[model samples]
Target chain A: MKNLKIDETKYTPEMTFDPETLVIAIKGKSYPENTEEFYKPAFEWLEKNLSDLGKKGLTVNLELIYFNSSSSKALMNFFDMLEESVDNGDNITVNWMYEEDNESILEYGEEFLEDIETLPFNLVPLKSRE
Target chain B: MTDCIFELKNDLNKNGIFFCFSGPISQDLIVEIGDTLKNKMRLEDASKSSMRLVFSIIIEQAQNIIYYSEEKVRPWSAGVNAGSISVGIITVAKKDNSYIITSGNMIKTEHVDKLKEKIEKIKGMGKDELKQYYKSQRKKDPDEDSKGAGLGLIDIARKVSKPLEYNFSSIDETVSFFTVTTVVAEGL
Candidate 1:
């Protein structure tokens, strides 16, 4: 399957889904007016890609800058989807990346890991280039 | 009860309120208000950086009202919309020689539980811990959307000199008019 790329805006974030390696990256500030409307297409694409099994390993990277509470529930649903997919035999690795010194992002990673039993999550620290 | 709309000059002169607006809000409204607040705060010699922080919080909280407020009035346009959001008087008043900023808003009951949960958690955290948690939340997939968890309160807490304070009145079981008052310390 072909890769899907969604661009980010001042109020939203970018979404990337690839069939080549089964990896996805979402990065940006997401306080979208309509959370479901914005995420519907991406979720569909992910479902399709996961079903095809075109890639052996699945990795999801979240390097988000910001999001609203509505987006928080959506993130949980996304992880739930991943958890189920892994239970279905997909090898999923989720990496939550945070900039060094930004501890809020780290705790969020820990919180997301609380419910998942199927995926391997790595909370990686980002070294400041400054 | 306020007639709600007083002439800007008279209102300012009478109340000493630096800025105030009450009614419909959206992204457009937020941008417009942000521009004005940013300017006024800077002119008052409030640090530009901290002022930006306050402006962002105002936008988020106001947007919440625009989207979630149940209070409705007959609309000549834009259909039935959310309740009003007002940015009341913000003074650079001194407390023991330090400056503090105070802003307020009214929210709904359903929204109140959620806000309280989040706010309480934020209050429980240490500054460094809150910073890390916020960073970690940001690092998560943005596609995993939340109704209020994202940048709204986190940004407010990060920018504020201390934790936020809130009060509310139960209009009924289904609704509440919640108010959030946040302060910023300007070292004397």
Candidate 2:
């Protein structure tokens, strides 16, 4: 499968789905007017790649500063898909990154993990680069 | 100059309002005003999380206008990416020790009752209950491809320090003006 890369815009996040690397990274803000339209491709890619990547394991990195409620719902669906992959015996790890000292963002990550049973989800605090 | 205009400014000043906008709201405008608001909050020494909370509410309110407001316009006549626009009023003001964000727009008269019920339910929930509701609502499928989680107001209700305030004023037989105001305590 080919990789998909979408650059970040003011109202949407950057998305990188790599079949070769077995990694999917979504970063930045997300509040698109059409949440389904924005996230459709990622879901499609995951559906196609989950089987192949299941053998080698996959890593998903999420580094979101802010997302609208619509985006939040889309994210929950995406994680559910990932959980399904794990249920099918895929080795998946989700790394949720948030700014240091921001417990609210961290809390969101925790909330997302509450329902998943098998995926190894980690909340990684992002330190300032400066 | 117009005396009434001066009086309006005075009225805003009397209420401790520092920023206000009315008319068309687009994604670009939200980013511009949101950046300025974040900078102002930083200058005021608001905590990082508080700034983020205020900014998130701003985006949700702006998106509510863009997606659901009855007053909409097409900014571009033709393009693969042409977009529709929505008009609304948004204001940020200070009341006592809290920061208040208010958004006003027009909605179909038929939607007023449902909106009222939703807001009333959110207003009655405490923080933990709000969190539980938000989680369950987040898991539900979107009613349509165009619809969202339909939880913006509930999410806003979660961040607020007190009960949310809202009003509906009839403008015609078909539509009404809807306004929602949420407040975040200064130190939260």
TM accuracy, model 2: 0.94
lDDT of 2 by residue, B1-188 (tens): 69998998998899888889998898789889899999999899888878888998888888888778899777666575776678899999978878999999999998899889888988888888999999988877645523567888888888888788999999998999999998998877
> lDDT at B182 for candidate 2?
88
Indicate the worst ten consecutive residues by lDDT in candidate 2 chain B: B140-149
With a 3 Å backbone cut-off (N, CA, C), the pairs that clash in candidate 2 are none
Label model 2 with its docking quality class: high
DockQ of each: 0.15, 0.82
Q: What TM-score do all the candidates reach, one by one?
A: 0.62, 0.94
**Model 2, which residues run further than 4 Å from truth?**
B76-82, B143-146
Candidate 1 residues A27-84, lDDT tens each? 8767676677888898888777775552388778898755555676678778888878
TM-score of 1: 0.62
Best by lDDT: 2
Q: Can you give the lDDT of residue B55 in candidate 1?
A: 56
